[model samples]
Target: MSEILSAPAPQVGNAESWTRREILQQPETLRATQALLRARQAAIEAFLSPLLARNDLRIVLTGAGSSAFIGDSLAPWLSMVMGRSIEAIATTDIVSAPALHLRAGAPTLLVSFGRSGNSPESAAAVDLTEALVDSPHHLIITCNAEGDLARRAGANTHVVVLPDATHDRAFAMTSSFTAMMFAALSIFSGIATMEARAEVIAKALADTLMDADQRMAALVEHGFERVVYLGSGALKGLAREASLKLLELTAGALVTAFDTPLGFRHGPKSIVTDRTLIVVFVSNDPLTRRYDCDMIEELRAEARCGAVLAVSAQPMEGDALHIPHLEDAADADLLIPFILPAQLFGLHASLKLGLMPDTPSPSGTVNRVVQGVRIHAIGA
Candidate 1:
């Protein structure tokens, strides 16, 4: 391991701390994540065994904010691997325009993600799906065991509670996002044995965790004024979460933006400057990775940005790339491994800027469940 790979891991919890201790320590969160995966698998096997057997089942993964992005990452892989049609739809849009998003009579499986599970939109979307669609089944994945969504799940719904620690105490979600994403991947892997997937997932996670433990301190110390995250295809949502992590963790001291690789050159590239830190999520797919590599190389040569970092699985052949993927590593779901870097980056940035990583927002401007938005009924 390089010097950058041996930094002290964040401590998880203690008696003195309320908010901050929750995420810095990993044991509880990791356990919770693993439990959530098991529960999700059980729920899917119980509810979806027969439905998935049918070819006409249309799977719709839905949520808001980080929750919504969980769907984006898993949709493509699940669609191809399981031979079922899957799409990620945002709950906000689903609430505002249910007819446009929901089909009238399709056998739809709406998989929802949430940290608190109490978000107004989450509940409303489920209600809307029932009203607008014929015979819909729901799979609710949430961190808050006592949340309304979990309580509302009846015989018709399959509800799985994520590990309690996944109900993050911080303003931004660190463990919850990755845990829910992993749960989604596990549920999709019903086509294969869960234990086999777990073996690969465990190896990938351990490696990333060890790498993040080392590199985070330096990335935070570099202290760029702004950060830009770039990804292509399904990764655009991960890019969004990565950008949001920095912004929220630092309480807006660090401005952030996200764009797809090809999308950036059109106009978003203007955001890159000497004080900006650019982090690119290289695609596993060869074609997409080529464009991602091209953009990073161009930026590195421009000397316009403070730093250009590639969080990649495959090593980039230069001094600039940060390769967390280990040699002889077992192949696993891509989303499982890529999330650790983003999680650690947010934690380090939060701590470096003197904001409590657990409670970045002391005044509660942003919250676990977003507040102050009234839910209005829409017309039929």
Candidate 2:
């Protein structure tokens, strides 16, 4: 008998309905965020208004898991575009070693990303930073309106809430990740205001959904046992997310792994077996694309997996086995579009594995906002 890995296929329209419903439900979060962002923009303006705006404004971008990847994606862009000092540090790291990530008596901004406001380390990081730093301003981005972080921004801090629908009921973060990311990008840069930029972003998202629905539908039909994801540069974060979405949404029925394109050659490539599904997130930058495409070609030549899929922002020169190219996706924002595809794949896998996409683990092994974490008061 053939091996069965994924859950049953969800009702055909279920994915589309969830997508639309989640987007509609997020308006309040989005609007409130607009207000919070404007306020943050004002506060930042005020803080810098007195002193000359320095390129050295230290920023620590943090979160756990998917939330951590949000920081990874934003840090480089903030550093290059805003020309500020930024680092993507996991709250776990700060919780373990505060001295390494913090500087005393320096003006620092802590941008914390959380889907549920209650991750233990998240609250702890804030407390630890306040305990150690001279002056720290916080910008909390979260999907849960009632989350501890969102409600606890206090008088001096800024809280930006994403769409309520972004609180992703599923085990994985589908809408929340993109919503929080866009909110951060909008806050730090004026990407939201540019008509052309908005158009491109919107188009990229639309195309991603339409194409992913078709491709993932077919992929899950194939029913592979294991999946390996690979990428480099900003795409590395995308690969991490893709790996998690597959693992989480499918409840680990499909074993998943991730590594940088070159990093995999060291030993991780051994994980690629005949039953594995290899998915590559190709880059848009010229230099990065060369490395990304080379790996895809190498994998195809080896044929180590049941299937090899490449999701790229642009078309590649050779005849490669992959899904459609996400055309005109010239920016890292292109990752936002690719996320829909991965999400669709996860959703389909969950259903194929006889799980519910809306609430996969009825046992409550996971939650929309994490539970069992307590908040403590730390003195300044």
Candidate 3:
């Protein structure tokens, strides 16, 4: 862990950019995040123990943009572990139509993820849940201690404010996203349970960061006009976040698409062209891996795309970036390491386009905390 902590930042674009620092500081941030969770284990359990006892408790994970994708990535895995159907609904969706997504009869737990925790929809969604649900508990996981979500702590709410460093200064999320996702996963899965696994996960992420920058930089040289990210199950959510990272960092300079490996064959495969770069996030599950590998082979066999790259924990045959020490890890653990290549590629691509990775959007159309969202009253 010291090696990762002391490793020099990758020389991508302006070395002093917050984007690069946030992206590179993940190894340290992850360790710090878990350590905080471990220290707060008693209080966390105190808050959650009684909630877990309810047979009819409805658990909903919500957020916006990159934050929303955190729930997308973890909902399925958490559902399996908790033995209940957990819902991953975006704050935007709930704020828009609370009736469709929330139930007033059921006792509910709303798990919200936010980096800045100031997004209009974030607080609005929580307000709507409190107004509509019969019995609602709030678990606000955010990087910002000063953000609105953290201030919502009360009798019915518990807030987990992450380390200040995770409150990303860059326009796009890198470490903030991973840290909040890890926090929610740790809280739900048991902090102590993750203690044994955290070191390997951090080490694997460090290895990927150390090894991926040059490769990602070279990949950016290809200048593919479009990119597609594919995965299965939990990895499918990761593919979505990966796609968003590229789109946001590149500022829409490169068209990007994301879908499950099997779903891509249905219609999305048509997006692949001679100038398209297709990257697959291969699953570690033996059954799911075969399907993911099949897609990789099929795309390669067709030879229509610019290139096909696989990011996998398992050893791959060709054209893949293999993450070390996670070959047998659960797909949930693979999420953080698996995202390194995409993050690096996004950073390098921004640098390649002469755009500041810290603020890729030149116009005021996009913002770090997001803008132009007006949270209307429920009946408005």
Tens-place lDDT digits, model 3, residues 1-380: 44534556446566337888888889889999999999899998999999989999999999999899989999999999889999999999999989899999999999999998999999999999999999999999999999999899688899999988888888889999999989988888889999978889989988888678888989899989999999899988899999999999989999999999999989998898899999999999999999998899999999999999999998888888989999899999999888888999999999889888888998868999888898788665
Off by over 4 Å in 3: 1-16
**Alpha carbon deviation, residue 215, candidate 2 (Å):** 0.9
| Candidate 3 lDDT score at position 330 | 92
* Per-residue lDDT of candidate 2, residues 18-97 (tens digit): 53344323323334444455555666455433332644457888998889988887777667776666789998888777
The residue-by-residue lDDT of candidate 1 on 1-380, one tens digit each, is: 22212334345653214333443434335544655566556556878787778787778999988899888777766777777678999899899888799998787888989889999999999998888888788888888988978887566688878766667766777667877877777676752455555555555566566566567668778878888988886677788888887778777888899998899999888887788888888877777789999988998888999888887777777534344543333223555556567767777787777777666776878877888767777652
TM-score of 3: 0.96
Pick by TM-score: which candidate is best?
3
Overall local distance difference test of candidate 2: 0.70
In candidate 3, the residue pairs with backbone N, CA or C atoms under 3 Å apart (3 or more residues apart, or in different chains) clash, namely none
RMSD of each: 4.6, 6.6, 2.1
Please give me the total number of clashing residue pairs in predicted model 3. Answer: 0
Sorted on TM-score, best first, the list reads 3, 1, 2
Q: Identify the leading candidate in terms of lDDT.
A: 3
> Model 2: residues >4 Å from true position, as ranges?
1-52, 191-195, 317-330, 372-380
lDDT of 2 at 325: 38
Inter-residue clash pairs, candidate 2: 6-352, 6-353, 7-351, 7-352, 7-353, 7-354, 8-351, 8-352, 8-354
